[model samples]
Target chain A: MTVLSDIGHLLLTADLWHAALAAAVLLLLPALGGVISERSGVVNIAMEGMMLTGAFFAVAADLILHDPWLSALVAMVAGGLMALIHAVVSIRFRADQIVSGIAINIFATGITVFLINRFYGLQDVGHLPPSELLPNLQIPLLDQIPFLGRVLFQQNVIVYVALILLLLVHVLLFRTRLGLRIRAVGEHPEAADTAGINVYRLRYGAVISSGLLSGLSGAFLAIGISNTFVPNMTDGRGYIALAAMIFGKWTPFGAFIACLIFGLGQAIYDNNSIIHVSQYLLSMLPYILTLVVLAGVVGRSQPPAADGIPYAPGTE
Target chain B: MAASSTAAAGRPAPPLAASLRRAGRAVAVPAGSVVFAFLMGAVIVAVTGGNPFAAYQALICGGFGLLCSGGENAGLQVSNTIVFLTPLIMAGVAVALPFRAGLFNIGAEGQLIVGAIACTTVGIHFAAAPAPVLLPAVLLAGMAAGAAWAGIVGVLKALTGAHEVVTTIMLNYIAQWLLRFLIIGGPLQLHNGFSVSSPIGAGAHLSTLLPHDDKLIVFGLPASVYRVHVGLLIALLAAGTYAFLLWRSSFGYEVRAVGQSQKAARYAGMSVRRTIILTMLISGAFAGLAGAVQIAAVDHNLTDKYFSDTTGFDAIAVALLGLGTATGIVFAAILFGALHGGGAVMQSDAGISGNLVYVLQALILFSIAANFLRTLKLRLPAVGRAAGTPAAEAPAGALAGESATALADDEGLA
Candidate 1:
């Protein structure tokens, strides 16, 4: 009862809401990316790898360049390059996407550590200066509002960017012609190819776009939320984002809602001192919730029709 | 053509030569993939301003103990590799069996963790029991825990049409967190230790292959220095069991049939759900055995080392590179075992990160999955003509195709 009251009290606080929103945005970006990538028929379990690569490069670039924007761009490019390898292997070579995704993840983990050893001589990647870190933008008058203002207006610049991306992705996936083609390609590539929709181009673009979003999320994690990059600092957040995407049925807005739920859990986890539950047990909640959702208790979640299948020309 | 010509001349081709040629063809892709990975690894090392040759020399010395510039003992290195590969053989079989059922079991890591947890729990509880009683109890307990862990994935997949990949990923995290919870202040934590469980009783321990005696010296080192244990024999036995089960059993046919086409298998009167569930249970058991062996022969307790354990993930590469054959899995396990053993030596001797082993592993996976040499052959007609026999498609191809239909069937259920 005390634990319940403690969680309830924490939830009522403005700080908790503010932290929750910030945490949600971190997952939202990648969840959105996952929504886009999976909608385009590529089973992208590699988001974790792409995001890790992005986080590594973001810190590495920021340490050298001292420009957060450029560092973020570099991070995105690095992630995009990783995505390109995944694309080439799964798409061009007709390899197993899951195997490719696993390879990408292993590659990211190995390369990041290897690069760190080479450059830092087994030392930690040092902390960034305050000015170089991605700034928390406080919207002047808007931040003055009681709880909503603190939650929405006073947040990291990347949070704002992610929220905007979420809206844009929702619109782009549902309303636009390009979005239609991407969905068409994912649903039935052969039919889409027959319709002259250029299935490969759309898939390539969708996959790269996912990498970009995930990279941005990584930048947010490394430079916006935290000051220094630790090994595996992203931990399993990218995977949680994948869960969120599936939980939301691969819709951007739905994924955002799912992210918010997971983000709330993260925020609560951050306030573990107030709660009586073991932190490790608390950490298992998101995965458990996702599993419950997958167990059909929350209704069935379906993937795109042709998802994970390589697009071979003239194939039925 | 040579065989055909010889046969046309009223005599069959020599059995040895024909078998040798067949074996050579079987070896080509995996061998090429390894060579490709090493070449790519060399490029990565060179690009990073490291001496690839020196790094590889160190790796070779550490793995096989052939080229030793660092005064490292050869016998110890080989022993270290044997210890490293003991669990991999079973874990590889775990992954390979699921692939045979067209169900990707990414939860082997999770299953292994739970197995370790169960083994530790049982061994600790039965600390006063005799060796004969405790040993089998702990191992069976481990296997049961692992099976239960993976059984969730299988049950959900079979009943609700939930994709095994997503469910397994979820379970993996759950198992990881559970392991953390158990060792770090949960029921299993050691009294004075942090992030480690209490050691299992001596009765539960698997005896080392060499006698554990400081007084006995072999290969210029104490016999105790060799950590290779009876688990190696168990692992080999597991591989043999897998081959026999896969090739000879009626259940094996059902698994293969289900893997090939669930609908067709169902039409042919085999229960697809039963096969799927049973395959996962058996797969998990093998993984559990791996975890049990590690506790019995190596770690002796659940430690923080299990937190960063990549054996299960590495098993994927092993299963794929091994072409899902028991013999191939053993050989692949050996190669991977060498790489893992060599990694530390490379770091210490060549001033390169041991993580390069993982990089090489990923490169090999990429090479195998993409069949890069096949593509290279296509581009070069000269090369293509030389290898007239088409490369055997990897078993992963069957898995890849089956997953698509399986996923499609899920949508129909929804």
Candidate 2:
């Protein structure tokens, strides 16, 4: 009973909601990316690595270029390159997609740490200046609302962008002809290929787009949410995003709802003092919730038929 | 050999030669991958303005104690390599077993940790017990815990259709955090602030390869200098068991069949779900043993070091580069153990970062999966009809056999 009230009281605070929204955006971008990539029949577990690479480069580029937008662009390009490696290895060479993805993750970790040590010479990558950091904005009239304003209207620029991308991806995946083709390719690549849909191109495009969004999330993590980049700064958000994607049944809107739940967990973790329990136990909540959700929901979720199988043109 | 003598009565030499050639090619692929990865590493070192030859020289010296001039002894270096190889052998088998069953068990790391935790708990709680009784108890406890951890994934895969890949990765994080919780102001923590557990009683310690007395010397070093333990023998025994279970046993035949073609296995009256769960249980036991051995033989307690344990992850590469075979896994573990043991020396001697080894491992995975040489064989019409053709065609055949299993594991979750 006390625990329930504690959670209720915690939810009542606007700061918690805002933090939850921020956390959701962090997961939402990659979850959206995962949805798109997987919908095109490519399994992308490399998002964690890609995001870390992006986060590293974003900080490096921001430190050198001093422009947040340009640094973000650099981060996206870096992430796209990693994704291209995955696409080529899995699609072109017909390697196991999961192995390729795991390799990408290990490569990202090694290269990032190597570069950091080589470049910084044991010095820390300093934090971005507040003036140079990505700015948070508040809506004009909506900001005047007592509770909702603080929770929804005022947020980092990336939060708004993420919400917009969520809507755009939903429409693009469900409503657009391109979206239908992507789904068809994932569901039945041979059929799509026979229909002249060019399955490889759609898959490559979807995967690279996922990289771009993941990179954007990395940039936001470094410059928008936190001031500086740390090694493995993205942590397991990329993986959590993957869980969100699975929990959402591989849908943009569904992923957003799942992300909200996970993000709420993270936000509550961030404010652990008020929970009146061991902080260590609190730290386990997100993972435990994800496992419970997966055990419950994954049994019912139907993924694309051709997912994780490489398209061999006429082989199918 | 006895059957071959009768079968080859007419042309025994040719069949024997063909089998020898097939074995040679199997050895060559992994060897070529290592060389190719090293060449890539050289290029990276050159690009980074480091001396590639000097770095490699340092690695060899550190790994084998070859060409050592300073205070470093070959015995100590060899011992370090063996220590690193011990856990890798079991972990490698843990992964290899699953690969033969067509399940990618990425949760070995989690299984290993739970194993270590279980071993520590048992050792600490039964501190008064004799080594004869307590040692086996802790080891079995670890195995059981690890099996249970992996059993969760198997059950989920069988009943709920959850992909083991995602579940395993999620479990890795959970296990990591659980370690932190236990050692940092949690029940197992010895103090309020430290991220470490109390040491287990001495009875839990595995007998070292060398005598405990520092005055006693063997292989040009004091006995105490050798950290290698009886765990190495246990690892070897586990490998032997893996070989027997995978090749000589009926259950292994079912596992291989399920891995090759789940539908076919089912048609042959094999319970696909039972095989998967059992295979996972055995694999998890091996991984758990690796963890338990690591704690019992080396650390003697849980520490922050276990939090960053890469033994399970490295086992993935060991299983792959080893081509999912027991003998191949041992050799692969040796090579990786050498690299890990030599990493610090490369950093200190050649002025290159130790992470160069990781890059090399990843590159090896890339090149191995690309199967460039095999592709060349398939492309060349001359070679296509010759000795290399059948071997080149084998992966495709294997893929076809495993496709149903892979499909069930990946896309059939629903």
Candidate 3:
């Protein structure tokens, strides 16, 4: 069929791979954050909302400061504040993590739109100026490597940073002492508390770090990929990242792989002109695939034992 | 939340006064949370250079038939509130039912959409059918579609041990996309090239309680403008059914047993898997009925507007705010429906963002989670959960208790 051949041709083209890589990094950041947060036993479905907040703040800051890096930092801080709310409610008050997460999302959605009305007075949040936007790098020597170079080397700076952070998170989750404590806290908080590890603190840190990563992803989406911020511009990418997290069985490296698969789907959707399918129908591919993958893989995957339960001292 | 139930279970008030006091303590937290959020919303409005009082006044006028001004009739606002509340009651029950069984039915939005689509499909084809033959048929089709949509999540959860939250969210996206595909340049698009389906035949329309004559006036509005129909009664009946089925029936007892303790329920000879699946199906049916009612009673056709319909998401807030009680859901739905009705007026009159209502809703949920009012119970004589325990945390915790975290146990076996 024409659709199959067109997809094959698209796969062979370097542009498709390059776009997929960009999209993968976008998902990878949040997926990594999800891995870190869930690994520390806090369920975070609010990544979508947090990322949207980050995207809004990132664009707002960039518009004011004329510096992409500063805006990105502001975005991260904004996300951290949202996560702090989740931490206090779920960890301190022992609220249901799902409810708390959903609340954060709803809060972010309402606050962002409300702020827009206050700030812009019904005007659209405009695009960043060229000089103020995140710059793409074309590695002098590496860019010469034909297909691989175009797909991997010549990309935005955040892409490189995300790849490195992926490695760092992977290492932090598996190789470090703090990582062991976090895993212990997530798996069995009572045992971790008895072992003298600060369960609450680790969870707080992991959740905050997830917010930071998600925020960075949001910044990339606003300044690095898209020029301006739209209300709910992040769309469902945060949820897709969540799917990536589950598909990877909650591992940073495995999540990266899942992100790439989802990214490919997104990239293909972006290039829907070649595919002989409805654009709306094409948009459903990633979500349907997530459902299928979840149905197939969730039975075999293992999450931390105390994953959604709040750890109350002396409860056990 | 688990805290409320635990508090009720832990303490048994002896005298009538003690029982009243206990009931007061239970109502205080949610009521206080709502009040606190409104105060905070007022502050935010003031900070944004808008008059909070005026905005709230507009909200009140838009939500109910009181203090209306500037060409806005009191009757219209009340009618708007009723129309908005109709679907929410059923959708709230949809979310609330699964919460009792310790399952999160986040797929209600997707199910609602499918139900609407099914209702529209049946209504469009059977345009010639009279009211009696058509009404139940479209509603059943919608319910069937909604149940099928939710059934997928149930089966996945029952067999593969997938988290319903994730699956439901995924399904929500699919449903949104499916809706877009159907009405936009797809099979259902209107002939005039609008991104809406053709209006259903007049025979398919629900009859208005008030005569649709301009000569008829109630509260200064023509009866023809009143969109409130028999759907309100249906919603109320659905609420009653939800209460009876969830509280008075043996099946409800089984569901509660499974929710409270799956191990205990299994030991008591209950089939855990069947209960899980059945609860989801019933929940889906309620959500489907909401969608069906929305299409049959209000919209009369599929439109792009359904893409932004927050009925399903609002249902989550409704179910939680109501504490999963039928009376609570009705009251919560009315409150939310009022907020929604008032939002447009606030936007027009106060030159303020309609989204302030959403912010208020979120704030209320946040305050509920914080359970700040639970501390008040401590001042009362030996009642409520432990000194610092969140008394409002029980129901919400139960929501995620069995399903969200249930997969952890199986992860070990795998």
Write the residue-wise lDDT of candidate 1 on B275-309 in tens digits. 88899998999999899999988999999999889
User: Alpha carbon lDDT of residue A150, candidate 1?
Assistant: 89
Clashing pairs in 2: none
Model 3 residue A282 CA deviation in Å: 2.3
Worst 10 residues of 2 chain A by lDDT: A271-280
How does chain B of model 2 score on TM-score? 0.90
Candidate 3 residue lDDT tens string, B22-139: 6777777779888999999999999978899988988888888566665688888899999998999999999998888888888899999999999998999998988888888988
Q: Which pairs of residues collide in model 3?
A: B1-B393, B1-B394, B1-B395, B1-B396, B2-B393, B2-B394, B2-B395, B3-B393, B3-B394
Write the residue-wise lDDT of candidate 1 on A45-139 in tens digits: 98898899999999999999999999999989988888889888888776778888899999998999999999987959889999999998999
Quote the lDDT for B402 in model 2.
Answer: 40
The TM-score of predicted model 1 comes to 0.95
Interface RMSD for all numbered candidates: 3.8, 4.2, 2.2
**Best by DockQ, which number?**
3
List ranges where model 1 is wrong by over 4 Å.
B1-18, B376-392, B402-414
Lowest-sum lDDT 10-residue window in model 1 chain A:
A307-316
